[model samples]
Target: MGLVDTLTKSARRSSTTSSEGATMAAGYSAERAPDGNPDDTEVLDKEEGNLVMALISQLRIGMDLTKITLPTFVLEPRSMLERITDFTAHPELIFGAGKIEDPKQRFLHVTSLILAGWHIKPKGVKKPYNPVLGEFFRCTYHYEDGSEGYYVAEQVSHHPPISAFFYVSPRNRVIITGELKPKSKFLGNSVATILEGEDRVRLLDRPEDGEYTITMPNMFARGILFGKMLLELGDFSSVRCPSTNYSCDIEFKTKGWISGGYNAVSGTVKGPGGTAGEIAGHWDQSMEYKDKGGRKQVLFDAATTKVVQKLCLPEAQQEPNESRRLWAGVTRAIKAADMEAATAEKSKIEEAQREKTRAREASGQRHQLRFFEPVGEKYMPNIGVDRQVSGAPLAKQSPDEMARTVKEWLFGEVSTSPSQSVASGTQATPLPPSASVSHFGSETATMASTASMQSLNSVAAVPVHVTAPGPPVDGPKLSIPPPHAH
Candidate 1:
């Protein structure tokens, strides 16, 4: 029998009621008495058993979950596109690049900023939706300095999923381009996801060409077999600036077999002439920096920093393909604790996508990526030039290699000006000033330079200024496109 059929039979054998099979199929919550509390110990135990059976069935289907259809209850109410915004939580670190001339200092600041951007959800185990091919999400950030920054992310590939993102700040004259290709493996009790791409940050106005290349650490979903589930970032990652000869190696420490540490990161920043700065801290909390002078200072404190809020048009005004707009029904259902409704809505979208894929295959057509194109082995903007820089490559090595590297840098002698190597196997060129201005998303080609969102029905209302200024206000009004003709 099929896995679903076996699971259904198992559910039926658990209880006398016919509703038990239906409940298991729908991932129903434990029944409650009129008082709104759980019904009884027997009912609770049976419900828990059903869930365990379902989880077992899911694992039996596949060890690699990349292509599997996960239940709606396990999904977080957001898309991967929305999750990428965590990088811009602190606008100062990005926009402040223009003020810092020293490459070493700038590299240090950028590394600290990148480490600070990892935000954990309230429920640590919930997963974000796997974006559909050609799906796009866009939003803008209004900084306290009255300057605006825009971000765009697209799911540029499907077979081996890849997310391409670009964030441009005209006022700061900085651009961030990245491709995310995660390779995940499910261990018997835990899952490991390795980041298989590099991200580049370039300052457009800098006279000397330089770019910061960053690689993220691997992630782990632990405690799956028993106990409370937890998400932990493991292994190590680094940030390097090739032109400046300054580099930071960040080691994310995972807990050991017996006991060691969790969320702990320690690294050394090597600059020109053997000068080094020490960085050590917990990623979700705060980090400390000891400069070449050996004076220690708090680099970033997530607990105290006022994270900038991201702004996106309301769902009603968002394009059909925007993350919020596409997942509105599923999000509503999840929020209301209606798992059945959430599953149904999510299935509808997935089924539509599958049908489209079948049609494309039959017609010998392909789903064209709207916002990004494949660059080398990853997806990046087809437009724009690059600014070349030198830096040591962020190599993927075993834990022992990383430990030895860190130990040599810390206890043993090492070169201050390490020879630079390309992380993406190519040099990044900076975009020309004219090319800096671009649109927000694929559906709504609204000018990115415009502060106010374009409205189709009437003249856009004057935005009320708050603690921070909003987007620029001088462009033709635009509105969300009507739903795509499916």
Candidate 2:
């Protein structure tokens, strides 16, 4: 059977009664559920099995999976723009990290904070909705200490598929700005999403410490063509703070055919003097950190951690281009297990986007961004920074002033005009000339192969000394074309 046909049949079999489905199709609940379950494995049903075989038949060993269309059953009920929030779910870990009297202790807290975010993911081998061009998502966090954090993200570019985001907790003196450029490829029985871009976090009060840069591990969906399907984070990632002269290289180990376990991670914390400590454990369970003197500490225990949920405005109050409101139709259909309706709703959105692109092309006008603007090779928030200065620095504004500025930047003038309400369509510009050969050349393929062969038991046992700083360890580079259409 064809992939869609098999998927439809499977969905029908698993769907609720007609009456229940009809009621659910009327409207999805406004209450947002948590992103994913704690479990990572799913046994394929008969139809899903057929669909997987059909999908594999159409693929090559190293083909890019971006243009390929997948079934609705494999989608998480959220947009990738919102999925980025998972990294910031546990704010308490780094709420006052900058305030620590010792710089080394502060850097350790920051390392733990980065490790805390990876454990929360969707159940099974599900992918989030590829955010349409110009789609945006915003939410607020109300912390226990009565401080509030604001976050906003926009699908800034579509051709190369870039999503830029900004977050700030003024009272907590924390700020984060980053972009994500995920490219997926089929790797035999497994699929890998090479997580590109960097996440920069700055503590406003600790200007001398500089900003910390973090890279993400690539996600692998293993055993897609055979065996039990499971999600794994494979390869290397790093956390570096230049001012503190400290860095942590993390290895998210993949399972081996005969031996290695899932989710195992091990890394060394290095500083100017020498190795400061070592970190080891399962990412989905508990991770431990041992200092040079052999003092062991719990870095993060997923079993005992409580994730703080983000709060969003009502759908009715959100702008037309907001992620939840924009994808509401498809989300409802998917939740109701109505594959036909889901496909139709999803097509409607995609078709509308195509029409917009055509209209922009005809007029020879580029899609104007609403919140972020391209700054050199990266995008930066139009607000929060003092543009009057040569190198834009955070405006010396009070917490209330910053909040007001953010509110205005997000909502803008409180007008009801259609122009003010909706974001523009995809940019008319093509990819930059450098993008074709930028990084991720032949060397990356070799790196990926080398990473896959690494065993979980190979973590180094001895501390290594470092006399000088080296280049920051970032995610593996990979050249990828634009993908994830619907």
Candidate 3:
């Protein structure tokens, strides 16, 4: 039978069964779970299969999917702004990276930290909710060593769908700032989310080593129209530090039709002199590093490492624009397996956003961002840091003072009591005309060109001698400017 015919038959078979076991076999039990964690292979129910078929009929081979409204079943019950926290899941790997004396070791530690993050995602082919403009998410991390980390992220732009975020662990002397602009497209039976952005990591204690810029790999959702839906990271990514002249080029290899394996990655670490080492293994399991001397060490093993829990205020305590509070109704409906109610709740948020956009266009007002500010084509944390000051650099600030400043900047006030609720800063303004109600812009559609596809496949061939200021020859180019240029 043809693929569509087989799906239809399966749906008909499922429709005839009234038993709870049959319903679970059709993925009903998984859908009703609060977390909605699916197995590696997701089985769509009759209703879901029909809905997906209808949606697929409307899509072109290489069409941009940013503006398309996806089914609620595919949602992960969290905003993209909050989902970005997955990158910093393992605080143990990142907190002490800067303290490593040797540049090569530090670079390797950073690479391991990057690779470790990809394994913490929710199982199944799921995507986080596209955050609305001006919506924000913030949380705190309490490390085992008694130190704390703070993270804040905001959807600063809507049309291009840019999420700017900041993370700092003052006691650990680490600061990370970055932006994510995800451009999704329908590629035949698969969908790809081109991760267009970079993370700038600064080791406050090791200022002389400078900042490390890390690029991201693109995400691919395979077998969307047939077979079992699966998520894979494809193409090239890199971690580079200019001051130390050290870099690591990583390739997230996708599984081929009849060969290859899922989550496989290979990388080369280069220093100022030449190639320093090589790394190989699966990103979701374990990775190993080998130095020039043939000395090998396990870089990261996901099975042994525990992800630190993040603390967020209760939904009732959160501001109206906070990610959890903003999507509470939709989340509750999804958890209860009420697709109709979920759709209605989701539509309310989307329609409210559209109304705000229309009102802004009519009033000729631009969106006023809360946590981040645009610096040229990039965005930076608006922590009120004065670079013009003669001698006092940001690196010299005490950890307590730095944390206080960041807290005030994010919450609009500094509170000493841990039990006190921190109010979210000023009410958000509507986005500008260019940043419409659409999730992403027209530029995303152009990213599916032949040239980009070729680049994605040839990542291993990229030259190692490239400097931090220059973009890599293979894969998606990083758009972040040089360190401290802002």
Q: Which candidate is the best by lDDT?
A: 3
Candidate 3 similarity to native, TM-score: 0.78
Q: Evaluated with TM-score, which candidate comes out highest?
A: 3
Local distance difference test values of all predictions, in order: 0.58, 0.66, 0.68
The list of candidate 3 runs beyond 4 A from truth reads 1-38, 385-394, 416-486
lDDT of each residue in 1-486, candidate 1, tens digit only: 764455445444544344334334334222111111111001323454355446645664226668767667667788877777777666555444544555665676578667867643434456687888778876655443334556778888777888899776655566788988887775533567778787888766553647788999998765333323567788878888888888877999877654565678899888877658788888877787776676776656666655555555456655677778898899899989887899899998888778888999999998887666676775655433342112221122222232223223321222211111112443322211221222111222112332221111022222211111111222111111111111
Which 10-residue span in candidate 3 carries the lowest summed lDDT?
Answer: 477-486
lDDT of residue 478 for candidate 1: 14
User: Against the true structure, what is each candidate's TM-score?
Assistant: 0.70, 0.76, 0.78
For residues 146-237, could you state the per-residue lDDT of candidate 2 as single tens digits?
A: 45567889999877789999888766677888899999997655678999988888877688888898888999886454434578898988
Task: Summarize candidate 3's per-residue lDDT along 239-310 as a digit string, tens digits.
Answer: 999999999889999876456777899989999999998889998788888888887777777666566555
In model 1, where do residues sit more than 4 Å from their true spots?
1-49, 58-62, 382-459, 462-486
The C-alpha stretches of model 2 lying farther than 4 A from their native spots are 1-38, 386-395, 413-486
Q: Model 3: how far is 89 from its true place, Å?
A: 1.2
lDDT agreement of model 2 with the native: 0.66
